[model samples]
Target: MHDPLQYEGRKVVVTGTASGMGEATAQILVDLGAQVTALDIKETSVDVETALTIDLRDPASIDASVAQIEGPVDAVFSCAGLPGPPFGELDTMLVNFVGARHFIEALIPQIVEGGSVGCISSAGALGWQEQLPILMELFARETFEDQKAWLEANQETWGWSGYLWSKYAIDAWVGWRGADLIEKGIRLNCINPGPTDTAMMPAFHELAGKEVIDSAIGPIGRYSTAIEQAWPLVMLNSTRMSYVCGEVLWTDGGFIGANSTGKQGGFGEL
Candidate 1:
């Protein structure tokens, strides 16, 4: 078992702490004796030592956060993102991909040496793993406007392809960010979670239906609790995982292993 005492006296900035896995991550960190700064939207209720409300979609809000939040931070745990409304996957893509990229670019300098940064992607993100070329093209463009333009130009061709594509970008970032962050003494990584019993569960079900939700293959038999999924993140953000970088730690049980064809993974497959 990993020692929770490993994080004593570290400072962490956690996004999406308003609820769900974000809340679970923050609670665990605080309990471990880390000074955690939480971030969510304008509407959040979790009372912590420090909580920053951010309109993650708006670059200005993100900038304000970096400007105001105390630094040099030991780690950044970006957990604020959305599945958005049913049929509004574009919003999901924007919040998850574009907004998250801005967060990294703006905050990289603040990460303390031996510090780590990680985010929570979903098992669903695996669907876009093969489109490296297109995803790279999207990453090349920096501003939200560029990403929005790419989405607009391709919306007709892609439909709600944004959500999956955004996550694809996230996974790509994890794989590609070590060069930039490693030099600063900070490591970057992420986790891909399978379906969980969060408020977002209803939104995902509403968008893709129960079959999609139930299809999140896991050896655990049923969906995981938010706290169950929060452990890997807690370790990833601390110095305890000092040598680990540019990796996506899958917290999705056997979900990815069960993704035979993504549509139908026979009863058994290794």
Candidate 2:
């Protein structure tokens, strides 16, 4: 059978692989015959070529992990994140966007031409477009410290929902930086997954009542599985998706479409 995804023997890096979508993505990549390097703050059970511990909230940790990774990577699946609450808002933003961005930027030189980067954003970032002005301002700061400082200084603006704002930043960064990466023969894209059933689900439920969480579900009528979310992310970074760059694939079972059309209710309403 032809390997349409072209992952066989490919060198790929997957973050947040200790559990949830990251673990699912790593397992799937391994099964597809890719050489997977799994990374997370905790140990991952996934059978990969390498498993490294990484703290996405710290630039030093991210840099250390990158140094350990053998380069000429074919793809990167950045799935690490925090659900907020137990973790502080700033810490959440650091792991979700700031640190993640720093890690990816560090790997850019090592990524082979045509390599692709796939990130996991959130459906909660529905109105990200409206927040672009401020997001751009945050992006203007080049260094990790500078961006972190900017985020720290602008807390009041996005502190209300670090998860939402971080997801918003992810969506924006994919489009904003993707344009530049593609010129180097690399592609960057992300998936804004709706509610997914993962270890992190309970945290979200605790933060924003179960009723509200369920309301975000579209016609799908249920939360997505880790693998369900992982598939689109894997596909987004596949060689086949060569032309698809700087795109946000809403892996929400029609939630975005339905919400946009006013057919889906509850979440994303004006």
Candidate 3:
């Protein structure tokens, strides 16, 4: 049988594999015969080629884990993230954007020339374009330390919602950095998933109330499964998607579309 997705025997690295979309993606890759190296703050139950503990908030931890993974990596699925509250705003930004970017940049040399990177952003980043100037400034700080310092100094600007700002950063980054990566024969893309029914749901519900979270759902009128969100991400990074570069695939069940058209209710009105 021919493998349309081309994941068979490929060396793939996935982060946040202990749970949610990351766990689902890792399992799917393993099932497709890819040699998966899973990274998470907690241990993953998935039977992957390698499983390493990593703390995205700490650059040392990220570097050490990346050092352990033998490379020439075919694909990278950046699925790790943190929901705001309970977790501090700074820590959330570090995990979702700063540290995640640092970790991905470090693995560039190991990633094959034609390889791709898929990341998980969120539908919450709906109005990111208006904030591009500030996001571009954030990206200008070339190092993880510098980015962290900038975030620390600018907390008053984005402190209200770390999750939203982090997602916005991811969306802007795919466009800003993806263009350069494509020149090197590497593609970068991300998915803006809507309200998903994962372990992270309770945190969101707690922070914004279930009604607010539900309001984000589109015509689908329901939350998405982890695997449902994972498939688009997997496909985005597939060798077959050679021409798809720096794109933001909305895995958000038409929320973005309907919201834009003013046909959707709830948060769109806000």
RMSD of each: 3.1, 1.2, 1.1
Candidate 3 global lDDT: 0.94
Model 3 segments beyond 4 Å from truth? 266-270
Stretch of 10 with least lDDT, candidate 2: 261-270
Q: Model 2, 156: alpha-carbon shift in Å?
A: 0.7
Clashes of each: 1, 0, 0
lDDT of 1 at 110: 76
lDDT of 1 by residue, 1-270 (tens): 655447777888888888888899988888887888888885446556788888777888889987988778888888877875763767778778788778877887777778888888877677556878777777788887787788777776444566667677788888877667787777889998888898788987787777757766576778888898888788777676878898888787776765654644632232
User: Candidate 2, residue 81: CA error in Å?
Assistant: 0.4
- TM match of model 3 to true structure: 0.98
Candidate 2 at 32: error in angstroms? 0.5
Q: Clashing residue pairs in candidate 3, if any?
A: none
Positional deviation of 130 in candidate 3, in angstroms? 1.0
> Candidate 3, residues 69-149: lDDT per residue as tens digits?
898999999999999998999999999999899999999999999999999999999889998988988999988899999
- Scanning candidate 1 in windows of ten residues, the lowest lDDT window is 261-270
